[model samples]
Target: MVTGLKPEKMAYYKQLHAHAWPGVLKKIKECNIRNYSIYIQKIEGKYFLFSYFEYVGSDFKGDMAKMAADTTTRRWWKETDPTQIPLPEAAAHKQQWQIMDEVFHTE
Candidate 1:
């Protein structure tokens, strides 16, 4: 997934994730998401965030629903969402993270 970072909010964003809430992390694991990672880059004066995770759940939608239903996750999103700027596709889809198709992967 991809999202733009607000330059002014970068510090807060990093600080929050540096010690991410345990409950949020637990919920993500409970939803069968693994190998989660986020990377940041600066290009053309803009900061972008790229996240990758492997989903190992039989019911993707159900897992997502479970994550959404977690109060702690909701609170976490509230703190983090304002630090990002959704891309056009993500905005159109009403999503903070824009899902990207895998073009190449080995292993």
Candidate 2:
């Protein structure tokens, strides 16, 4: 998924992720998401965030619901959401992160 970062808040965002709360990390794992990673890049003076993770569960919606219901995750989002600028696509879809199509991948 992809989203934009508020330039002024980039440092704080990085700091938060650098020492993510243990409960938040535990909740993510409990949701069956693995190999999660986030990358940032600056393009045309805009900072964009890209996140990738492997979902190894059969019930995607259920896992997501579980994650969302976690208090720690909600708290985490509260802190990070303000630091993001959702792209048009995401806004249109009422989502913070816009899903992207995989053009190429190799194992």
Candidate 3:
């Protein structure tokens, strides 16, 4: 998934992730999501964040709901969501991250 980052909030965003909340991290593991990573890049004078993760759970939807219901996760989003700038299409639907289609993968 991808989202644009506010230039002004770039440092703060990285700082927040540097010492991520322990409870939130615990919840993410409990939800069966692993190998998660986020990368930032400057593209055409704009900053964007790309996030990747592997879901090891059977029920993706249910696991997501479970994560969403976690108080710690909700709290983490409160601090991080404001640092993002959703793309036009995603903003139209009130979403923060835009889903990226996987065109090719080899393991």
Candidate 4:
């Protein structure tokens, strides 16, 4: 997560994430992404979310492609994409999620 949603929108955002969308959650599981969680720090009424997920599948690219091709996933992105801040590269095109580097992992 980049920045906090507006005060009025925060509640709705929290509500939706409380029980993530079924289709989106299902697609994540299908892609072998597990032990996923998002942490938030609130400062001056602003929220910042740090998310982490384990990738258990062998073919990351293939799985991502499969997820991207899903209609449900596309629709889900449509709903949440507007709320997110894309990186400069991502902003130049249609990217639902951006890749992040893994600095360190114990296991």
> For this target, which candidate reaches the highest TM-score against the unseen true structure?
1
lDDT of 3 at 79: 97
Question: Can you give the lDDT of residue 70 in candidate 1?
Answer: 98
Worst 10 residues of 2 by lDDT: 89-98
Error of 4 at 13 (Å): 2.1
Candidate 1: tens digits of C-alpha lDDT, residues 10-91: 9999999999999999999999999999999999999999999999999999999999999999999999999999999999
Model 4: colliding residue pairs = none
- On residues 1-107, what C-alpha lDDT tens digit does candidate 2 reach at each position? 99999999999999999999999999989999999999999999999999999999999999999998998999999999999999999999888999999999999
Q: lDDT of all predictions, in order shown? A: 0.97, 0.96, 0.96, 0.71
Q: What would the per-residue lDDT of candidate 3 be over residues 1-107, giving only the tens digit for each residue?
A: 99999999999999999999999999999999999999999999999999999999999999999999998899999999999999988899999999999999999
lDDT of 3 at 39: 99
- Which residue runs does candidate 3 get wrong by more than 4 Å? none
Instruction: List the candidate 4 regions with Cα displacement exceeding 4 Å.
Output: 1-8, 42-47
lDDT string for model 4 (1-107, tens) is 23334455566666678868899999999999999886566778665555788889999999989998999888876766565555556456655345567787685
> Of 2 and 4, which scores higher on TM-score?
2
Best-matching candidate per lDDT: 1
User: Which segments of model 2 are wrong by more than 4 Å?
Assistant: none
- Candidate 3 local lDDT, residue 60: 93
Global fold similarity of model 4 (TM-score) = 0.74
Question: In lDDT terms, how accurate is model 2?
Answer: 0.96
